[model samples]
Target: MTARRPTAIDIVEVGPRDGLQNDSRHLSTEAKVEMIAKLAGAGLRRIEAASFVNPKRVPQMADAEAVLARVVDLPGVSVSGLVLNGRGFERALAAGLREISFVAVATDTMAARNQGTTARGLVETWAGIAKRAEAEGLFRSVTIAVAFGCPFEGEVPLARVIEIARALAESGADEISLADTIGVATPLAVEERFAALSEAVPGLPMRAHFHNTRNTGYANADAALRSGVTVLDASLGGLGGCPFAPGATGNIATEDLVSMLERDRVATGVSLELLRDATLWLEGEMGRRLPAHGAHVSPWPRVLAA
Candidate 1:
């Protein structure tokens, strides 16, 4: 029997935050706002538009408040912020963002290197953030970074991921996201872990965040869909990486992912042509040819808007 696939999906654009955090260049606040506006114009409804981390740690996101102030009014679009600690979460709350994504790593070494905490400590942090967001009636999501594998700690056990997810689910996360931080996951692994998470934490929604660092990100996305995950994350122009993860590459490009999904009759509600156009604009602004192939190629004929 054929497996059921989601006819439609939500692709949360992480371009403004995760996409730029690792870049050598820091885009002006105006440019960042323009990027978010252009992404929303292309039908990206859910966008991770800013990160509220220390400027010294991730300077590219230093203008988090300024960027949010400008883009929060985009009609019919949801603007969110990423936070790694209580202070960042508090800043997001003060900024009045309705949604926030909190990240927790899978292992101690990655946690220390990424944020100078233990994985368990991050989980504790998430519980509190979730509680505060709930009290504030804000949408809260927790991403399990390096769920597939960690550069510092070769392989992260599946049990550990399930444990972390269980804690988040119990702690009031509106959504649970799994990140392939360095992109070491295969399709099989993606399917297995998502299935296991579903079984362990029944009924909670799942989101997938894949990096194209190993060229397996798209395949992992397919597996996540087949495993009943409808929400996925991508960076515009395929331009993002975790600064904590060495040798990691950009994310699965939004245009490329949209093109692939549209071909399979999966509705992402994104305009492929416009996405391609956006990719070109981004490349020109950043002054580099992104790893994504969508801008270099033509969208499938049938998927174009009239």
Candidate 2:
């Protein structure tokens, strides 16, 4: 008998934020807003608009507020931004953002390297931020970096991910996102970590963010879908990578993932034609070729042939 499939999957388009953060070419604020509107038009309901971090640290996200303000009026869409600390959270709130994300690294070395703090210290800081966001009824979510493996600190233990998950769950985080920050995740590792997290924090809503750096991102996503993870983060044109991860490329393309789901008889509430057009438009705006593997792979050639 064939394996059963899910009826639908939630695709959180992170191109505007995660995908564009490390790009060498700077996109104008207008261009960013246009890209977002196109994605929304392509039927993406949740788009991570920008990061409310130190512009000095990520110059690519300097126009985050400007981008967010421009797209706030898009109906049926929930816009979000990432905030690293209390100050960033305050800035996000002041920018009229209703949803926001915070991040914590599960390993001490990665946490320090990424944020110059210990894992415990990062958790404590996120706890405060989560509480504030919850009290104020703001959309509160936290992403755990290096949940599968860390580039700086190779072979992160599963226990560390669970510890961070449990802490975020207890800290009033509305959602916990597991990021394969460096794209070193395997299907076995994804299943193992997610199962561990589920057992530790029962019923805590979870999301998976993967990078196609090693060509395992789609497989990792497939594993998560089978593991009952509903929220999946993908980018248009697969246009993202972790700057800290040496030799890493962009994320799994949204069109590619959606096309696969559609071919597999799973629903993603996204239109592949629209997604394709948006990616092509994004490639044109970026003024160079983009890294969209699924478009090249033709996941549904047999279906298209018939």
lDDT of each: 0.89, 0.85
Candidate 1 residue lDDT tens string, 151-259? 8899999999999999878898888988998888999999889999999889888999999988898988888999989899999999987675666788889998898
Once fitted onto the true fold, the runs of candidate 2 whose alpha carbons sit more than 4 angstroms away are 1-5, 294-306
lDDT of 2 by residue, 88-125 (tens): 89988888888887888889998787788989898999
TM-score of 2: 0.95
Best by TM-score: 1
Could you tell me how far off, in angstroms, the CA of residue 16 lies in candidate 1 after the best superposition? 0.9
Q: State model 1's lDDT.
A: 0.89
Model 1: CA > 4 A from native: 244-247, 302-306
- Among residues 3 or more apart in sequence or in different chains, the pairs in candidate 2 whose N, CA or C atoms overlap within 3 Å are 240-250
The alpha-carbon deviation from the true structure for residue 153 of candidate 2, after best TM-score superposition, in angstroms, is 1.2
Candidate 2 achieves a global lDDT of: 0.85
